[model samples]
Target: MKRGIVFIATLMMLGSCGIFLPRPEFEKGMTERRFLRQNRDAKISNLDNGKTTYRVDRGERFFVLATFEDGKLVKLEERESRPNWMTPQEDPEKRNR
Candidate 1:
């Protein structure tokens, strides 16, 4: 019985892993304005090539880079592999060091 319980618990833990997996947003064809509204506090850098890079502060020591062109989101790259479930309302300095 104990072994059965342990096995079930392990299976449950493994099954829930997908819930924490991060999904990439900011795919091609998304509007820049909409992205900006979603990431309201993101730090933005405008490039000379008419592309803008938005540095998003993801909580728990993570961040993401989103690039836009012609007011449309063109690219999204994460600085590290992590979950995208972090809340934007989190304090940047405290969680992302």
Candidate 2:
């Protein structure tokens, strides 16, 4: 009985310490890559600083960007859809006059 009690106590301590923790369904590295690939269409650009911009095609269309550092997601930025237009440029000579 004493041996059984000790075993149970040890098991409880190990569980609390997460020594026998179950493996996650998707590992961290794989999960991050999968997420990025699955949403590639929404990706507009990526930066070496670990920042990525995604263009979500939701109801009104929007842009979402996120930053990650040290394998951890850190920041997110988003903006609503807006027209992207450029104004006509005058001749350089005219502008110099």
Q: Which numbered prediction scores highest in TM-score against the true structure?
A: 1
In model 1, pairs of residues that clash are none
Q: Which candidate is the best by lDDT?
A: 1
lDDT of 1 at 78: 80
Residue lDDT tens for model 1, 1-24: 999999999999999998998655
lDDT of 1: 0.80
Q: Model 2 misses residue 15 by how many Å?
A: 25
- TM-score of each predicted structure versus truth: 0.52, 0.39
lDDT of 2 by residue, 19-43 (tens): 5675442233333455566555555
Candidate 2: regions farther than 4 A off? 1-31, 50-61, 85-96
lDDT (C-alpha) at residue 75 in model 1? 82
- Residue 71, candidate 1: Cα error in Å is 1.0
Count of clashing residue pairs in every prediction: 0, 0
Model 2 per-residue lDDT at 79: 69
